[model samples]
Target: MPRLFTGLEISAQTGLMLSLLRGGLRGARWIDPENYHITLRFIGDVDDPTADEIADALARIRRDAVEIRVNGLGSFGNGKPHAVWARVEPNRALMELQGEQERILQRLRLPAERRKYIPHVTLARCRSATNQDVARWLSEHGGFQAPAFTAARFVLFSSRSSVGGGPYLVEEAYPLSVAGGLGDDFNADAFAGHDFG
Candidate 1:
């Protein structure tokens, strides 16, 4: 069984920019630059049959390529602060693409997602980092922004189910160039502290 999901791949240049914010904050395990992505939907471990059906359904989406803007920085746990991420500014195209994925998956009988979708590219997982620690870190790096990029494609990725950063594999890719199409990936509840798998 594979742990699968869909996501938008971040450019290496953007990843390098995001990587610069790695240290200083104590107890943060930064994700590798290669794993940097904006997840569109998390499809948990599923039977091969369901996976194929999902691929087929997703490939049918038609929407325009989304213009991604990494505007700022934020943390998930609020006062508790479990994770930190680069915010993906949500717009109509991005929101609709994600919403379409949500509907398609629910139609596949996957349980409806319980959390409101918040678009973000996870930067690090917080471990024992204090409220003050996070606050200070946010103050220092909150102005983080990457050059806006056009997402021409979205992909279905598979990952090993394990703790500690990712080595997520791309299983299927769905291009977002059909005049109109959906995006690639997103997470469970962002505040829920999920990795990019």
Candidate 2:
């Protein structure tokens, strides 16, 4: 069994910028920079056969690369404040990709996602942090932004049973055809050195 998800990996430069926003929030476990990603669909735990089906279905997506912009910061949880994340500017390409994934998963018999999709790159997980703590932290560092980057690929990532945010393995990869010369210089080597932790 594997816990699976499809997501776009953040570039090294963008990861570095997110790393600078790590501290100051007590009880918040900061996600390692290399682990930062914008999830398209979280498929949760799945058996081996199901995982294979997911991979096969995702490989059929023939979409073009999407331009992703990371801007501002916000936290999840209405009153409890469970996580802090970087906002991903909503764009049609992103929504279409995510929507396609949703439909594919549902067609494969997975339960439909109940919550509406909100694009974001989770930066940290908050355990004991309060609403006031999260608010103050947001107030101070909410202006965070990173240069726009083109996502040339989305990955099928798997994680073992553990606290979230980290050590995700790339089980499979799906490339997006580049429009013009947008992703001509992008290469997997830029994301290869880390230990996946």
Candidate 3:
């Protein structure tokens, strides 16, 4: 069994910003740039049948694409500072999408997430240390912001451990229809410079 999650990839520019932040932090494990994502739902380890069922459910979710912005940097926990992450600017679209995904899973009796949904993109993982370093980092970098962009789809990813570290393998994708297809006006230029595969 493998752990799975639904999330959207961060843009290249945003990824570069995260990489810079990682370099200055102490006691932090820099996350691979390719692994950066805003997680919607974590399905944990499940059997093949459950994975297939979840995939099927995800495909049935209907929503238009949305513009989400990545803004600010922060750390979690009071003393140890377990994690550092890029905060998502508050957007109803992101929250609604998260809620929809949760409802779909709950219908299948998947256990609820113990923690509340706080939209963020993990930048680093921290181990035993005072949060003083984290506090200073946040204060200095909190104003960081990325260009607002439309996320038209999400992926169901499988993480496999390797000699280097774990790499996220996208097992499936769920497309969001836009107005050109579902109420969103898309700019092909936004994707013109990128190679997804």
TM-score for each candidate, following the candidate numbering: 0.88, 0.92, 0.86
| Of candidates 3 and 1, the better by lDDT | 1
Per-residue lDDT over 1-197 for candidate 2, one digit per residue giving the tens place of the 0 to 100 score = 78999999888888999999989998899999888999999999988888888888888999989889999999999879999999999899999999999999999999999999999999999999999899999999988889998999888898876758879988887888786754754776634422222
Given candidate 1, what's the lDDT at residue 59?
A: 82
* lDDT of each residue in 1-197, candidate 3, tens digit only: 66678887676777787777666667777788878888899888777788888888888988877677988888789657988899887688788888999999999899988898998988877764468878877888888888786788777877753322248877777777665663243333333221112
Residue 128, model 2: lDDT of: 95
Task: Name the runs in model 1 displaced over 4 angstroms.
Answer: 178-197
Candidate 1 per-residue lDDT, tens place, 1-197, comes to 67788888887678889999999999988898899999988888887778878888888998778888998999999568899999999999889999999999999999888888899999899998998998999999989989887787777888888854588877776667634343333322221212233
> Model 3 residue 104 lDDT?
91
Local lDDT at 20 for model 3: 74
Estimate candidate 2's alpha-carbon lDDT, on a 0 to 1 scale: 0.88
Deviation in Å, model 1, residue 183 alpha carbon: 15
* RMSD each, Å: 6.9, 3.5, 4.9
Q: Rank the candidates by TM-score, best first.
A: 2, 1, 3
lDDT of 2 at 67: 88
Q: Pick by lDDT: which candidate is best?
A: 2
Ranking by lDDT: 2, 1, 3
